[model samples]
Target: MDLQRQIRNGWFFFLKHIFNPLTRRIARTSFGPFAIVRHVGRRSGKQYETPIIVSPAKDGFVIELTYGPDVDWHKNVLAANGCTVVWHGKEFAVDKPEPLDTETGRAAFPPPQQLVLNLLGRKHFEKLTCKKDE
Candidate 1:
C-alpha cells in the first residue's frame, strides 16, 4: 500500500481503538474545540456518540470531515437529516447538514486551525444549522 493509504489506515485504527474512547470520556465536558455528536445508525438503529471538533458559525456549526464524508457518523447524520451536538456542556439540536467547499469550510475556522487542517490535507466539511424554535 502507498504511504498515504497506510498512514490513513493506521490513523483510523488508532482513532477507533484509542483516541475515540479516551476522547469520549472527556469530550462532553471538556471546554475545548471537541464536541460529542449524537446520532443513530441508519441500518442498525443503534445510537452513537462521536467526538468531533466543531467551530461555531452564525446559526450553527462547522465540522471538518477528517475521515471524509463517508464516515459512519457523517453518513448517519445525513441519513437521519439531523443530529444533536453536545458542545461546551450544552446540547444543541442541529439539522441541515450540508457539504461545504474547501475554501468556504476553511473560512469557518480560525487561521491557526485552518492552517493545521490545510497541512493535514483536509478539504471536506459540513455545516450543521441549528434547529430554530417554532
Candidate 2:
C-alpha cells in the first residue's frame, strides 16, 4: 500500500478511550447525555464505534457530525443509512445522519462545508458521497 494509506490504515484501526471514548465533553455540554454511534470504515470495512451528540427526530435521532468529511464514521454513517448508536449508556437505532445548519454547527464548521449543509438542509448527508453532493 502507499505510505499515506498504510499509515492511515494503521492509525485509524486503533482509537482510544481518550479520543473515541464511551463519553467525551463536547463544548462543555457533557453531550453524551444525548448521543453516540457505532460504525466502520466505508472503504476499508474496519470496525469502529464511538459516542457523539444527537437530537431526537421522529422515530430516530439526528447527529450533528463534528469530525467532518473524510472520517470513517461519517462515511460509515452515510453508507449504513442509520448507524448503531448508544446514548447515555443506552443503545438506539439512529437514522438520517443529517448535518444540521444550526447556528452553532454552521458557524463552527469550515466555511465551505457549512455552505453545503446550508444548501442541503438536513437528512441529506446520509445520501451524500461528500459535501459536494450538495
Candidate 3:
C-alpha cells in the first residue's frame, strides 16, 4: 500500500480504538467545543455515538468534515435526514443535514478552531438545523 494510505488507515485505527473512547467520555459535557453525535447505521441497524468538534451557528451547528463528506456518520445523518447532538450537556434534535460552502462553514467556528481546521487542510463541513418545537 502507498505510504499515505497506510498512515491514514493507522490513524483511523488509533482513533477508533484509543482516541474515541477516551474523548467520548467528555465530548458531551458542558465544556469545550466537543459534542457527541448519536446516529444509527444505515445498513447494520446499529447505533453509534461519535465524538466531534462542534461549533454553534445562528440557527444550528456547523460540523467540520474532518474525514470528508463521505464518512459513514455523515452519510448516515444524511440518509436519516437528522440526528441527535449532545452539546453543552443538552440534547438537541437536529435536522436538514446539508453541506455548507467552505467559507460559510469556516465562519461558524472561532478563530482558533478555524486556524486548526485550516492547518489540517479541512475544507468540507455539514450544517444541521435545530429542530423547532411543533
Best by TM-score: 3
**lDDT of candidate 3 over 4-107, digit per residue (tens):** 99999999899999999877888766777789999999999799998888899877899987778778988888888899999988899999578889888888
Weakest lDDT window of 10 consecutive positions for candidate 2: 125-134
lDDT of 1 by residue, 1-134 (tens): 99999999999899899999877767677566788899999999999999987899999999987778888888899899999998888899999588899999998999889899899988998898999998
- Model 1 CA deviation exceeding 4 Å by range: 1-11
Question: Could you arrange the candidates by TM-score from highest to lowest?
Answer: 3, 1, 2
lDDT of 2 by residue, 76-106 (tens): 8778775666655555655545554466444
Model 2, residue 40: distance off in Å is 2.6
Reference-based lDDT, residue 130, model 2: 18
Q: What is the alpha-carbon lDDT of model 2 when measured against the actual structure? A: 0.53
Sorted on lDDT, best first, the list reads 1, 3, 2
Candidate 2: stretches off by over 4 Å: 1-17, 22-34, 104-134
- Cα lDDT, all candidates: 0.89, 0.53, 0.87
Pull out the clashing pairs in model 1.
none
Which one wins on lDDT?
Answer: 1
